[model samples]
Target: MIPGGKSFCTRHYKKVTHCLFDLDGTLLDSEVMYHTMIGQICEKYGKSYSKDNAVQIFGMTDREVSEEVCARTRLPLSVDEFERQLLDLARNKLPIAPEKPGADRLLTHLFDYKVPMALATNSTEQSVRLVSIARPKLFGMFNHMWTAASRTRTSTSWRRVASRTNPSPHNASCSKTPRWACRLQSRLACRSLRDFKPELFGLPPFNEAPPSTTVPIHHS
Candidate 1:
């Protein structure tokens, strides 16, 4: 578990009445699966997959990643064909993807408290369904789920979805940029599920101080 994991939530328990989460790296530990599958596929075309490539495609949509890879590798596949292949490969793998640390605990705590929660992911609806099957109980806890595939094909869609899902002034979101943070009015930005600080999102601090800690919190 990340340091101050317990206090991270306890500190912010009261400030938020609703929560929105990013699915891929934030809630599900599925990025490794994506990297492995994409790497294997790229290798089949005699293209190398590097760490930098993975970082560049981290928050991109399926079509975007496919286009990027194809452009970089000169793959002969069309965008649609490449995206289909990726999704086909991912469907089998995502069902077994693990949830990120603290995902279940935080989600369950919020659910049990009757706090409304929504999933805002860059993944397609199909990918989201695979994750739902993999983590049914956890996925079911969300009051709503939105995917980039279902929304308009624009960068602004994520922000629209986040704002649409939680119009409450006290709502909070956990995600990196372009997925759920682009133009959304969020109180906190969590780089990963484990390193979140609820207190930063307007939740009151814990009565007792937690151990000093620091972790990378990505922003875009």
Candidate 2:
């Protein structure tokens, strides 16, 4: 059973045949680091950055986040300046951020089993590149990856990629963190990912020990 005693539905899980992933808190444990960095930037302008502030930018693109932060904080910096600061901090911090527990393990399992997977994140390609530098093997496992900007530019690309696994979007499971982070929200939380039973989703079971920490998962 999921949290709140929601009955687990094996019927629906059986239909899921593909997986899409988000990066920040999904594969990488860098969501907190991101919030901290934004707060630090806001503090420089004598503004406080709260969870509420972070929530406002949850599903936004990189440029949109910069613009929203600058506007909300009244930070004298232009959007470019604000984004530059974020990039500077990211350069120093993101590469060192650890991958979410079981992330590599799960991805490896899926890859080994020939599961069709893709990455669909709001992060810029540059940010993805930086993070990938720290874990090339893991990132390389995905069949496709797209930034928010790139996704918008090539809207049909997702469909083309999704077709590799199943023709319908309803057949894919989107793996992501927290409910509010995406337009297609799922009820399950990050804690469930750690204890996830692959057999529930008709996937091969893990033959090794589970990781030490929880992983977040969302289905769409």
Clashes of 2: 1
For all candidates in order, the CA lDDT equals: 0.69, 0.72
Error of 2 at 58 (Å): 0.9
**The CA-based lDDT of model 2 is what?**
0.72
Q: Say which candidate scores most in lDDT.
A: 2
Candidate 2: lDDT of 112? 90
Best by TM-score: 2
Candidate 2, 158-215: lDDT as tens digits: 4544545433344233332344463455533447356766666666678877676976
Instruction: Give candidate 1's TM-score.
Output: 0.71
Residue 141: error of model 2 in Å?
0.5
Error of 2 at 16 (Å): 4.0
Residue clash pairs of candidate 1: none
Models 1 onward score TM values of 0.71, 0.75
